[model samples]
Target: MHLENLITQKVKEAVEAIYDISLQSVELQPTRKEFEGDITVVVFPMLKLLKGNPAAIGNAVGEYLEREVKEVVAFNTIKGFLNLVISDTYYLNFFNGIRTDQSYGYVSGGQNEAIMVEYSSPNTNKPLHLGHIRNNLLGYSVAEILKAAGKKVYKTQIINDRGIHICKSMLAWKRFGKGETPESSGLKGDKLVGNYYVAFDRAYKDEMLELKSRGMSEEEAAREAPILKEAQELLRRWEAADPQVVALWNMMNGWVYDGFETTYKNLGVDFDRLYYESNTYLLGKDVVAEGLEKGIFYKKEDGSVWIDLTDEGLDEKIVLRSDGTAVYMTQDIGTAIQRVKDYPDITGMVYTVGNEQDYHFKVLFLILKKLGYSWAENLYHLSYGMVDLPSGKMKSREGTVVDADDLMEEMSETAGSIAAELGKLEGYTEAEKKELYHMIGMGALKYYILKVDPKKRILFNPEESVDFQGNTGPFIQYTYARIQSILRKADFDFNTNVLAEEIEGLQDKEKQLLKDLEAFPQLIQAAAAQYSPALIANYTYDLVKDFNSFYQQVPILAEPDTRLRNFRTQLSKKVGEVIASAVGLLGIQVPERM
Candidate 1:
């Protein structure tokens, strides 16, 4: 049982015996640093039922607790707070119980119905960028955290493969390419395709400028640009299933898919399932028809379908155009329903998208509920803020966005440079050093992004994230490595449990470490419930800091007493295991050696 629960029961017993009044609940918090106690019980709430001075009431409760509870060895009353000092034997016994349990903080799955997480739904026209990195990391980490908290999860993404943006790349390639392919051009397929997307934008702009100079209005020039017309025509032909256009669409999209696979692998994110816009774009039309008959949605005079949500504080949103073509919202509705069909076990879903789509998801969920889907209530929009570089915001159409692959490579190089300067790779081979560099680099990148609350914007600095001190990822990874070093140097087997009576007393740092360790299980549940990886990330940092302080002050292998040394070694190992487990939830890998 948790110490808080044990103390709460004792406090209730104390209050009943001393005040002759039955208490409902007790409020407890970690004692302030200046207060010399492990936990503090707030006594002010009891004043509501029992009329007395707060300090006198606290003293009465403290006296009863110290006399009756074995764990409460000493107590101090500071006005309205009763701070209780717990026994060293209790913490040592707690440590012994969990020292060998590898899955100490993780709960088993199947505690509730499954959830589907959707993220990284990128367009096929361009490679993933910095924004996609955050989405993938957040989605992947949230899925991992939920699993650790005992929920079955399915990772998924919807590829935007069919759209006007895609047609822009296709038309440009057809018009300007002298039969250039990825292999011939010696560029990644996505990059090759992305270059043409920029080419299309540039050409379209030049044509619009020329028409404007020739006395055409800006709007007329934009609507009549030859390149724009060609791209629009290409979209129409592909949608109509024109053989040649469809074949070209398949070939180019296939190239982009291959390129995306490489990037996803390097970024260390994976999906259990994939959905394509091409297949799901027309899916919600039948559902919309049913909704019309049921009066859930109304058709406008121009033959467009819409749902008026003005009563719900939102404007009318169109589901289908006058020409009977489904919009993005319609596609999303169909995709969500289809996902439920694909996996009936899923009782909820989390959509990891940028904050720009906050309104879109609100409408989507409300519409689903209005359409009588019970699962709609469990839907959540895991909206996150954008990641900005030192330079500024990115635009994909102009080819200015930071490519995910290049940024990852840059991170590896930066990590390698810092590692060399620190001279920590002395005995490591070139290949080993290279692998470690990537590990540290990726760990730094993931930790920096995940440590912030999802809704908070991040100004990412690669150099700062790789620093070996402070609240950075490499700082936590280095401490984990130090713990590994202590384990490696301990000559005897430290896995055997230490008898409770063998250790005389707990040092302040050691007690602090144990207390931090005790919070891990509950923290996992809290993080999962809140859908905040920042909780786990910051908790691990605090645990690591405690362990580091303990390491510096206490002797492990150098201790003269065998039992005490063994206990310290066991404590260090457990801390390392937890650090690995917690960091793994954030999709980071820790090295055994710095």
Candidate 2:
């Protein structure tokens, strides 16, 4: 067990023995401020039993625990609270344990609780934007955290590859003339595909106004529309499984996936599997058929299919539209059923979609449960908030969407500029500097987005100039660099046996630093349990800040006292290790320099 548990247990046992009462809830927390001692536990509940003086009861408990508990060096009572000072031996023992287990602070490859985390379900009509980055990072981090907590994490993505939007892009591509592939246009697939989508929109608007001015019937005008007709024909061909349409669809999709792979690589997000709407949409037809056979669904006169859940307080949902074509909901049901059939023992599935789709998942899960799938209860929809710009919420109609690649480029350039200003990149070659720029930039971006509560909309005002001064990724990174500098300067052998008694010779700063470093594993476990990465962000910042202040106030190598310096140096190294492991939990890359 960790020191917190060990110390708290001893204190609880002491309370039971001394007072002859069960110390059911003894909470021991590190002192928020230094003068409060290393840890504090309120003794107010025990006060009433003592016939009333809180301070008197606290003092008695404090003295008793200090004398009995091996974890406590000394104790005092103030304002009904028992403050316990952790003995240097407690910290020294903790640090020794950390040193022995290389991956002491992290627990990956969790038990057989498998999860499928779906994120970045981007439409094929557009390139990824800033909004997608938030989704990707959260999904990626959640999977990583679950994996660390011993879950079999399955990171997955669904490509919104077929829709009216895709049809629009194809319509524009067909009408706009001379055939140009992503290769011919020298453009990324999404961008190349997106350009035509934009073209279709523009042309559609102009033609509609012209048709109105000429007083043509709306239906007649729409039917005669070339782009609209082309998109309709393409959709028909696509649905019919025409060989040429299928080939073109595959080719374009391959390019988009290639481009997407590059972006995921840079963002440190990857998936174990991918589901395409192209594949899932067709599967929905079969699921709808099964639901009908099982009497779980009813059909409308127009040949449309639906699930009735009014008793469940959810509106009846359309699984398929008239004319035997599936809508969005149809594909979702089909995909979900397919997944369960594929992995019957998938203990859980996490859908990392935006909050707007909260109702969708609610109904989706309800339907699954009604369909007699007990495992449907294991499904979880993690609805995250939007990523708004400093100006306002991102609106595609307002043309305010921030393209992901552009944002990364801007951030990387800014990082390079700052690195040059700091002169920290002096020893690195041009290529190394470029690599560092991207690493730091992406780290800042990931940390910025993930540091906020996923349910709260975030304003990215700092952008490329995200300060390293406070609770930022680079600040934690700097602490690592500071520790590395200390290690480089130290001349002692870390492998040498140093007894717990020898740690008593260390400085006060070393003792304090080591004490804080011991909380690393607890912080990680808490972050995972809470499913709140913001907890880790806060913890990492506090740890780094504490270490930084300790380093600045106390000299590691300046002391002429050999044993003292060696012990302090070792403490600093352990502190760095703690920070490294904690930061790694968020999937953030820590640069050697700011």
Cα-based lDDT for every prediction = 0.92, 0.76
Give the C-alpha lDDT of model 2: 0.76
lDDT of 1 at 441: 94
Instruction: Report clash pairs, candidate 2.
Output: 110-150, 110-151, 111-150
Model 1 local distance difference test score: 0.92
After superposition, the stretches of candidate 1 with alpha carbons farther than 4 Å from their true spots are 9-27, 42-57
Look at candidate 1 and tell me the lDDT of residue 166.
93
lDDT of 2 by residue, 104-190 (tens): 766766556777888898888777888899888888888777776677777898898876677777767767836888778788877
Instruction: Residues 1-594, candidate 1: write the lDDT tens digits.
Output: 788898999889888887788999999988887989999999889889989999898888888888888888998999999899989888898888898898998988664779999999999898899999999999999999999999999999999999899999999999998789989998888998899999999999999999999999999999999999989999999989999999999999988998999999998999999999899998898889999999999999999999999999999999999999899899899989999999988999999999999999999999999999999999999999999999898788888989999999999999999989999998999999999999999999999999999999999998999998999899999999999998889889887789889888888988998888888998999999999999999999999988888988898899989888888899899999999999999999999999
What are the RMSDs of all candidates, in order? 2.0, 3.4
lDDT of 1 at 400: 95
- The best candidate in terms of TM-score: 1
